[model samples]
Target: MAQLLVTGGAGYIGSHLVLDLLLAGHDVVVVDDLSTGHHLALTRVAELAGRGCRFVHADIADVATVASALDGVDAVFHLAAFKLVTESMVAPERYFRNNVAGTAALLEAMVRAGVTRLVYSSSAAVYGPQPDAPISEDAQLNPESPYGVSKAQGETMLSWMCARRGWAATSLRYFNPVGTHHSGRIGQPQRDAAALAPRVLNALQHADQPLTVYGTDWPTPDGTCLRDYIHIADLNRAHLLALQVLLPGQHGIFNVGSGRPHSVREVLASCRRVTGREVPTTDGPRRDGDMARSTADASRFHAATGFIATGTLDDMLASAWTWAAHNPAGYAT
Candidate 1:
């Protein structure tokens, strides 16, 4: 089994990927600052791996700390970054320093340690607002938000580094990543309460509260923002497949998504139906950089690795509701 290092492995998507990597019988190591993540997620990873995993609590920008963690690692999965668009707008420097500078530091460390393969956790926001229904990998990148720019910059740097240093890299540009692991032992913890599903589920479990639907005048069937939501399990499996590609082939870029667009109203309605709660609704103005619709074309990854998302929208809502009901206060317990 290969040894893999996951940067931000305690966070939502990273934690799930860590669990999947361990289950696949690979030696795993994680580095997380716990800024927006829970230490309990790392603890749960340890519980599941049972001595097959190692975790270090440190920011990815710390070259010395990250260098030590990268020792003897074959490949790296860089997932550490500030993800919120609004927060990135308010604190662009923090996002740049953490996402861009931190990635640079990690790349330097990887080169120094002779680690030549990497799988980066990129975002669909890099494409910004596209006129097409489903965006392909070849779509023109014009990121609208600072978060998107930071991720786009990270991808550019990885591409340049891979070409210059002969390193194998894959930037998996992910669409909306949702759902929990099927086991339900570890899912998105309480720290990610601001996310869409978590917020809806939290409101549903707590009381019959009014759910705020941001921007109800979009150009869609339901007049709400449409997104391609992929399951966490499927996203993690795609990561493994990407790593395998790096083993014997050249670097590439791939999109991980279900190629289905569901509106915000539809997601909220799904949550309401699953929880059997009276989810009152309210309309609000659209947030900055909000797109009317954003979906991905998964033909590249599908042809390259034969990957497909198996979870449905109902499955995503049910798992999210299950996690929220069990942990009302997120990961505090």
Candidate 2:
């Protein structure tokens, strides 16, 4: 069994990945600062998997601590970072310090520990507002927000590491990730999430809080922004596939998405249909750095690794609704 390290194991996506790795017979260690992650998520993940993973409460920017956590780790899954676009725009320096500088420190620690295999969790935000319907990997990265810029810079660092350092790495540029695990025991436990799916679920659970439909005048089918929403399960599977197929001295960047564009209104309709509840929404002006449409061309990853996203919009909403209905107050409930 391989010993693996996940940088943000207490967060939503990282928890799922840690469980997946544990079930696959790998020894996993999670290093998290808990700045925005929940310890309860990892607790529940251990309960569900019938085994426990080693948890080290630390930050990736701490090269000394991260170097210690990399002990015997065969590979690393880098997922810890501040993800809110609005927050990053307000404080660009924070994103640069945490996402960019922190990543540099982690790479240094990995090299010190003699571990080179890495799978970076990138974002489609790196593409900003592309004119193409399905953006390919070849598209020029013109990130609008500081958060996006930080991710693009991370990929650039990985490219250099692979070219000169002989590191085997893959950067999976994810679109909007929605849905919860099928068991509903672990999901998006954060309450103030900025993602549309979590915000919709939160609105459905509260009578006084109505979901804000941002940018109702966008140039899309329903005058709302269109995005490629992939199921969390599908997104995690892509990571496992990449981890399994990573070759020595090889580097690749692939897009992990559903390749189907679902607009904001479409998502609301699906939530209403799946939950059998009226989704209350109020139209609002567009948020800064918000894109009109962002879809993915996932054919490159599919051809390279035979990985395809198989979840529909309704399927994603149904799973997320199950989690929200079960845990209205999140893990605290």
Candidate 3:
């Protein structure tokens, strides 16, 4: 069985990936600084899997941690990053340092440790503004925010590193990822998530906390932005698929999305329908570096691996609501 390391394994999607790997009979190691991730979620993951997975409570850029963690890792799922677009806009340097520079250090350690295979958790934000259609793998990357720019630059850095170090890698440019594990034990453990779905859950928990519909004036159906919301289960599955199938010397970049774009209003409606209550929301202007419409074509990745996201928006909203209902204050509860 292969030994794997997940950079953000204490976080939402990475934790799911860890459990998936363990179930597949592989050894998994998680290294997370717990900035936005909850350590309790990792505890629940170990309990649910009924196996003790190795966890190093450290950052990806920590050389000692990276070297120690990379001791026997066959591959890595790099998911650690500062993901909020608005937060990245407010603090671009932090995003660059953590997401880009941190990634560089990790790659160097991987090369030194002779671990090559990697499946990077990238974002569709790398493709800033495209036509109101499915963004193919070849879409020009004009990232509008520092977060997107950092992701784009991360991909470039990976390319160069792979070339120099003879590493094989696949970068999955994911759209909006939502939902929780069916067990409801590990989910979006971050209480202050700026993403749309978690913010809706947060609003539901508190009566006075009105959901901020940021940028309702974007050019789309109902003047709101459109995004592809893939379930966490489906998204993590893609990582496994990439890891299993990618051959050495194969450098691939693919998009991980459902290929169906749902607008903000549509997601809100789904949340309301799932919760059976009107979600209190207040209209707010668009945050800097937000896109109008962005969805993944994913045909290249699908045709290559037959991996199409099967979760619907309704399923995403339902799973999110289930997680929120089960854990009101995230892992704090």
Candidate 4:
């Protein structure tokens, strides 16, 4: 019953959220610059859901355009940002201007439009390197990379806005988001993608390109990086839950993950089990800004939003393989 606006509605997570909203009988509007997002994503989500949503081609940094998109919007899911850690480290100015300052502009626009609720897409990268297996939400936030720092700053900005305006805001600090929609209609590499999820899918999309297992010397069960991989569908559902549960004059931070750590080798083995193919693999040194292990402590999110992630590791791998096999070219079909 609410009219929602998503800032990066043409990207992976954003597009899925748009579909979820529309299918729930809510009005949805999207604004995306098409810089790294594909407009075809919105088109396909509309087709699959059998419901149409409006999309405006614009950047979030542009206040006027953002204000226009906020017309009649009751809340927003702000997911627009450049997400590559290496890229962010190299060009931090872009990250600051786009992720941090762009969010500032969006908040100003929302205030002007009297839109007072938001679900901010944050990252667990903001937690930086942790020695422990599963880090709690209350743990110190010492983000090492510029990307993480930018997201942390965005959270601060959102807090200020909520304090001053009585806006309902929930900053979902996402762990690793993997896999795709169960439908396979919308997933993977609509554009150039980095990180483990896309890299794995891209390797499969291209013929026999070896999946690189980064950092094989960590002190873990397998010596590979341990991550909290949450299925994108579960993560998307939590957003809906957060949006519906949050009311005005409230603000909080919550972690989104499976709450269990899965090693890179396990993920690769799962990929093989799902696809029944021997995916090529290689070992490499750890990339910059990566931790040995990081998982979410989901107690807070469960108590607050009543969102429980039920998808298993096999389910994540299977859904990812399904989408990759069908749409190797991602919406080019």
Candidate 5:
């Protein structure tokens, strides 16, 4: 079994990946600052993994802290970042300093420790709004927000460092990551009140707040924006496949997504069906930098590793509703 170091493993995606790695018989060491993640989430991971896992409460930007956590680690899953497009616009410096500079520090530490294999958690925002359908991995990258710019810069730095320092890295660019673990033990427990499905389900289950639909005048079949949603469980499986593909001298980029597009109205309609409640939604002006459709052509990863996304949109929405029903306040309590 390999020893994996997961940065920000207490968060939504990170925690789910940790559980998957542990179940696959790999030892895990997680480093999280808990800025946006919950401490309770790590507690749940420990319970599920049965004491074979380690949790280090520290910031990824701290060189000494991260270096200490990297000792004897076989591979690193770098999932730590400030990931909010609107917030990044309001605070670009925070995004650059944390996402870009912090990644540089982690890479430097990996080089010093002779740990070369790394799987980076990248995003689809790097492609921005491509005026086409089914965006591929080789598309021209034109990031529109600070968050996207930071991710693009991070990918560039990873490529440059791999070439100059002989480190093997794989940047897995994700589309829209949603849903929860099928076990319903852990999920997206963000302290901030920004998540779409969780918050919408929470309002629908508890308060009768109207779910605001942002912009219904898009050029899609349903007028609302279309996005490719991947289940957290399926995403964890893809990460494991990536780890298996990362050899001593192999490095590349792959997009992890379902390759199928679903509109906002469809998702809301599914949520209403699952919860048996009228999810009231009102139309609003389009947010800046919003795209009409952003789906991925994830054939590269599938061709390389034979990993196909099997979860459907209904599965994603149902699992998200289950998680929301279990944790109503979203880690606030």
Candidate 6:
């Protein structure tokens, strides 16, 4: 079994990925700042995996701390970043400092510790509003928000690092990650969630609050934003596959998505079908950096690794509903 270090192993995706790695019989050491992550999620991961992983409560930018965490590690999965588009528009500096500078620091720490393998958690926002339905990796990266730019910048840094330092790095440009594990042990934290799925689910929990459908006049079939939503399980599995196939002196960038577009209204409808409850929504103006349509043509990744996202919209909603129903306060309970 390989020894791995996940930089953000307590967040929604990180927690799930750590669980998968542990179940796959890898020794994992998670280093997270707990800025947007929960310690409880790691606790639950340990419980579900029937094994415990080492946790270092520190930031990835902390070179000394992260270097120490990298001791005896084989590779690193970098998933620690600020991901809110709206927030990034208002506070671009924070996104650059944390996502870009922080990534540079992490890479430096990796070099110091002599662990070269890396799997970066990138985002679909790098594509921005594309006229095309599904965008490929070769598409021009005109990121609309600072958050997207930061992710793209992280990928750029990885490419240079791979070329100069002989690091094997893979960047997975993720689409909207929905759903939860089948066990319902961990899921998105509902409080202050920026994503539509968790916000919609949180609205369902609170009968008085209505889910806000941002920008009903977008250039889409349903007049709402179209997104490529992938199940959390499928996304994590892709990470595992990417980790296994990483090669030295090479850098790979792939889009990880369901390769299908679903509108905001469609997602709400699916939530209703899964929960058998009314999803009250109010129309709102589009937030800055919001995309009209962003799907993924992940054929390249499929050709290279044979990994395809296998979760339908209904399946994603059902798994999310199960997790929300089980963990109302999201690890607080």
Q: After superposition, how far is residue 62 of candidate 4 from its true place, in Å?
A: 1.8
lDDT of 2 by residue, 43-120 (tens): 989998999899999989999999998999999999999898889989999999999999999999999999999999
Query: Candidate 6 regions off by >4 Å?
Result: none
TM-score of 3: 0.95
Clashes of 2: 0
Q: Can you give the lDDT of residue 292 in candidate 6? A: 87
User: TM-score per candidate, in order?
Assistant: 0.94, 0.96, 0.95, 0.95, 0.95, 0.96
Candidate 5 TM-score, C-alpha based: 0.95
Cα lDDT, all candidates:
0.84, 0.91, 0.85, 0.85, 0.84, 0.91
* lDDT tens digits by residue: candidate 6, 35-88: 999999998899999998999999888999999889999999999998888899
lDDT of 5 by residue, 256-282 (tens): 999998888988888878778877777
Q: Which one wins by lDDT: 1 or 6?
A: 6
Clashing residue pairs in all predictions, respectively, total 2, 0, 0, 0, 0, 0
- Model 3 misplaced regions, further than 4 Å: 215-219, 286-288
At residue 17, give the lDDT of candidate 1. 89
Clashes of 1: 2
Model 4, 237-312: lDDT tens digits are: 9998888667676778999998988888888788778877766778888887777888999888998777889888
- Comparing 2 and 3 on lDDT, the stronger one: 2
- When superposed on Cα atoms, how far off is each prediction in RMSD? 1.8, 1.3, 1.7, 1.6, 1.6, 1.4
Clashing pairs in 5: none
Q: Clashing residue pairs, candidate 3?
A: none
